[model samples]
Target chain A: MNFPTKVYINEVVLRDGLQLEKKLINVEEKEHLFKRLKSAGVQSFEFGSFVHPVRVPQMANSGELYSKIQQAAGDADLIALVPNLKGAERAAQLSVKNINYVFSVSETHNLQNVQKTTLESLEELHEISDLCIENKISLDVSLATSFGCPFEGEIPTDRIVSIVHQVTELNINTLTLADTTGMANPKRVFQLISLVRSEFPKQKLGLHFHNTRDMGLSNILAGMNAGVSHFDTALGGLGGCPFAPGATGNVCTEDVVHMLHSMDIQTNVDLKELLKASHLLEEIVGHQTPSYLLKAGPYDKKYPVPVST
Target chain B: MNFPTKVYINEVVLRDGLQLEKKLINVEEKEHLFKRLKSAGVQSFEFGSFVHPVRVPQMANSGELYSKIQQAAGDADLIALVPNLKGAERAAQLSVKNINYVFSVSETHNLQNVQKTTLESLEELHEISDLCIENKISLDVSLATSFGCPFEGEIPTDRIVSIVHQVTELNINTLTLADTTGMANPKRVFQLISLVRSEFPKQKLGLHFHNTRDMGLSNILAGMNAGVSHFDTALGGLGGCPFAPGATGNVCTEDVVHMLHSMDIQTNVDLKELLKASHLLEEIVGHQTPSYLLKAGPYDKKYPVPVST
Candidate 1:
């Protein structure tokens, strides 16, 4: 039942959450949301991704959005997702301070997501790593499908360990293990995180989870128990699994903050302000997000007592 | 990260899940659902309540439904909820083998719900205890708002401890601490359950949680860590807090079973068959439920790989 006194949240709504969205949000709107989150005490963000416009039109304005919000970010860490060397080049050109290079450990997902084999993606990660160093940008590597693969199922722990070993060899700021399709359980997360921590004691680690099977928060708890504090979450739970059409998205930022704060595990984020951002996100997305806090409110919220019969 | 190897589920969908629904399902439909759940290896059920028909019109046919399904239930535990002496009399006249007596720990909620104060409810519990023993029926007591109340806010730990001490003095078969408004966090759940366990070492205890803040599964995990094994869940995540509209309901049965099985903690319930029952429940309720497994499937389900581009 032991837990960390505090945890770090890296907001990913602008990148991972909005990537699969149908309506492409303009740069102004993205900046507006960014400023709102900044006011809500979000110190780190995966603001956007530098992928091709044709492939993911929703994130086509990454550079424009960054330019608009960078000044307002103050001391906040603004990170961009870079899928390959070209994405790295785009991020470097935009003077993005941090970049997260992501690849799937599962072969089929790697091919489907990036049109490259696992080996090819690792090669690209090397190039992306070198590019980030040359451009004076902090680099973070995320091993997607580290938990399990939607198409392949049950990824071997050895595969993730080997990938982590290879990725840690580079000059990276953090290594994140992602449950790309929300296939991880608490036991798997605890075991994998414990193994990786023991193997790479000096390496900084992060976790990204999805609530697709309603195990997202539980997995995060397990990861925290395993000594990993950094986590990726989306505002209002505004992301969806492209492969699993009706499934839910990432671990919700507001919901996670609410739960953490309730448990006395500080995230330094204001739940009320974060919920306001989540409400605004619902408007931006033109739909209700899968946020428990948004619907149920916080645990301490008091309702007026009804008249006695 | 340690968990119970096998946990018992007390299905409460028939009573709790449907009590709030506006549409009234017939006895035949209830029988159908009961048979479906039984086939899925569910051996215990809070099948229906014996409240006044005018108060809970949805459960008006509890006696008829119970009679229809009792023969088919075989050795399965078909328990009925009784909120007062009249309800207990109704259950006794129907020859019900087991009955659950529930009252709110919060005086405001108890007065608002049952037109009685907490002390008056305890007085009635003594009477009901006598009634159950005379009728040769097992009795279980559920203390609602054990975590926090929507109107009263945080219920004192001392209050709950005192209530548990009083209730365990009766001839109750089991005692359940219910998070009536879904306000229990993992830390609170762990501390409260641990305290209760130490106070009543020989008492058979259970937990009932709501997913209002998305901490239902995590709280269950914490409760398990504190040595409690029995839980109450609803199919398809049915049920809601009458005090908090639009909030999610109880911890979903199939989702809980899925996570437990994934963690190698057995529930002895077939997840796939349980899903089939959930689907039937969705059709019966005429709306999509808040079930994660219903939307995302299980972690082990392998989707066919799309044709390579």
Candidate 2:
């Protein structure tokens, strides 16, 4: 709990959020969200990813989006999600602050998601790390479906640790244990996080969870106990997986930041500003969101100070 | 994970659903939902709580409902929530299969919720345990707000454990780490359940989480990873705490059972039947529910047999 006191917020509205929307947001809207998120105090952002435009038309102008996001970040770090070394190379070439290398732990998910076995992906991660280093860009590793996989259920924590060990050889400074499919519970979360922290005390650990099954915030709190200070979130509880069955939304940014702030914890974000950013995202998406706190507001008790008649 | 072949399901729709409804649900409608849920293969149930009828008038027929539920549960384990020793004794006299004795872990919550300190409530639990033993009825202990308290932000895990230890003196066979106020995260949940299990391995650990801030199912998954098997859920995601600030519905039974069964993990329950039960409950409540799987049927990849061109 004390460790997560200084949470590093990674805004994923551009990449994870936009990727799920039916209407493709042009480069301008992507730039608008990133700038607004930055002004609202998001420390890091995943601007449009470097995937092929033909494959995902929503990200056709990723290169251009990255350039704009770098400017919008304004000294704050901006990271782009990269599927492979090729994406990493493109991201590294940009002025954007960092690159997050994404891979899946479950081989079934790895093959289906990124079209590579986890082992092959790990090897590629090493190569990607080399490329990021060569280009003088920072890199963080994200293990998708580390908790459970849509195709392969109940992923072993040992399997996740092995991947971490492999990534450690590449000397990546940080790793994220992502509940990519929303299959994590507190028990597995605590065990995995504690295992990772105990094994690699120096490596920074982050959490990426979805509220698909509605355990995103709880999992974050569990990560807090394990001393994790970094997390991934989307505004207005937007974002879901088209491939993963039963997936809902990513843990809402305003919800997580709201819960943390209320606990007297510092997330270095403005609550009202974050809410505004969420509302704007909701407007852009042409949909209402799943954030209850944004609609209801915080619970506060007050009194007309006992009449001293 | 191996031990999770079959998960215990406790249907809280009657008690939790009715407790939160603004309009009064007559006894006949309550019985209808109860019969439908039991018909859907729910092995256990919380028909209604033994709280004062004046406070929760919807629960006035708890005693009458207990007798009716007994006929329905048959071999199924039936239970009820009790706020104090009086409620426990009344539940015991009714000879319901089990009684869940609850007390908040936070002092402020204990007083605000029950007009007594946590210690006083614990003493009442001791008396209830004695009553259960004397009546040859089964009893479970619920440490409310074990994760975090609304009035007191963080209730230390050690304090939660201490309450578990005190309740164990009465030899209560089961303990539910309740996120009464939706303040628990997976990390805290994992650590707490792990501690309780390691301390009292034989004790049946249950988790009762709230989706108030939207992390209920993930918390359950976390709990499962930490060696928990029993859970309390409401049909159609009904129920929220009046005292517990920001508390929402319990983890939806249909959603959790759906995920576990789809993964080939056994819960010995039928998914379609549960959905039907959800529909029945929705009819009685006169509103739609929050359960996604209910609104949209279980995830399926099957497409209609190819038609001749």
Candidate 3:
């Protein structure tokens, strides 16, 4: 039950969160969110993605968003999602220092999602890796549906490990195993994480989980127990699962930080400030967000007794 | 990271779920729910609570509900909540085979919730234990706020241990540690469960948790890792934190069963049948319930693609 003293949280609200949103946030609002999240003590931020604008219109302002927050992103890691070589080229042109190229490990999910087979995506990733290296950008490979697929049920652990082997052999040091549809359980997460750590002892690992089945925090705890501390979380739990209809988004950043701090584990993020950011985002988005911390406050917060006015 | 081969889940939806619900389900509806839940393979059911009707109008028909479901409860454990000697006497008069006497561990919470100081509640519990013994009823003690308190945060381990000592001395073999406000983390849960297990090696333990802060399942995992298998869950995640306004209820019965089955941990409850019960409850309640499994379906369920209508 031992947990790491510190865990790294990369706020993905601007990227994954907005990508699935119905309304497209303008560059000004995105910049406001970026600065607010940065002030909340988040050291890592995923600002936008390089995917096609028509495909994900909410993230169409990535280029402008990157430029808007470039000055405020000093010392903090700024990341973007790049789906292929063209997306990587767009990110490199934007002078993005860190990028994650995501592809699904499940064959049917890969083909349905990105219109590419697993092997085809792998080949494209090789070219994308070359482009990243030439542009002097840090690239982390993200495997979507690495745990299980909405289209094709449970993915074998060996398949995930083999994909890790291929990516690591390409000299990519950082890899993220994403629970695309929130299909991961604690035992499965622990087993897969342990296997990945055993096979790639020097690889930097991150876990991205959706809260579709309410297994997000449990999976995070399992990752912590397995000695992996890096996680991707969205502010206000802003993302949605495209394949698993009615499923929720990524784990809420504020809730994750709150739990970690309550457990005496350091997240290096201010929970109070994070919750403020969530509130601000909710206002800008014109709807309520799915953040538990925003709704429930901290554990020690006391409710005011009812008074007759 | 080892999980038990089998876990015990005592569905408390009939009692805890309806107690806080605004719409009071009639006895016939409750009987139908009870039959459905039992058919779902739930071996233990907390059917009703013998509390004042003014305090909780929903559970006023504990006697009649028990009588209606008595014929269907064969070979399965039928449990009821008894807050004091009077409640225990009522339960005994109804010929209830199993009963739980609940009291808070925190002094302030005990007084505010039950109008009794911690010592006073313990005194009442002793009398209730005597009544149970005289009637040959199996008594389990439920300690609310065992982990944290809304009035007094972070209850000392020694205080909980002391309460356990008192209950164990009363010849109560089964005990439930309740996180009334969902203020539990995995490390704290494991530590507390470990301490209780060490002190009372022969004690049968169950954990009751609220999902206020969304740490319900994680705490369950911690308890499971500590070799505490029994749990108390409510259908549709019914039951709110009376103090923490807007906080959700106990962990959803179907979601818990879904995760357990996904993790290869046997709960002996059919997930499909459990979901059917949740749907039935939602129809009766006339609103969307909070069970994640109802919204997202199981991990293996696939969604149809969006079509141009």
Shares of reference contacts reproduced by the candidates, in order, are 0.88, 0.13, 0.68
Better of 1 and 2 by lDDT: 1
Using all chains and alpha carbons, the TM-scores for the candidates as numbered come to: 0.97, 0.72, 0.97
Ranking by TM-score: 1, 3, 2
Off by over 4 Å in 3: A241-247, A304-309, B241-247, B303-309
* Candidates 1 and 3, the one with greater DockQ: 1
Please list the C-alpha lDDT of all candidates, in the order they appear: 0.89, 0.76, 0.87
Residue pairs with colliding backbones in model 1 are none
lDDT of 1: 0.89
Which pairs in model 3 have colliding backbones? none
TM-score of 2: 0.72
For model 1, how does the per-residue alpha-carbon lDDT over A52-148 read when each residue is reduced to its tens digit?
7887788889998899998999999999988789999989988999999888899988877788899998988888887877889999988888898
Candidate 2 lDDT tens digits, A128-155: 8878777788888888888877667767
Error of 2 at B195 (Å): 4.4
The list of candidate 1 runs beyond 4 A from truth reads A241-247, B241-248
Q: After superposition, how far is residue B89 of candidate 2 from its true place, in Å?
A: 5.0
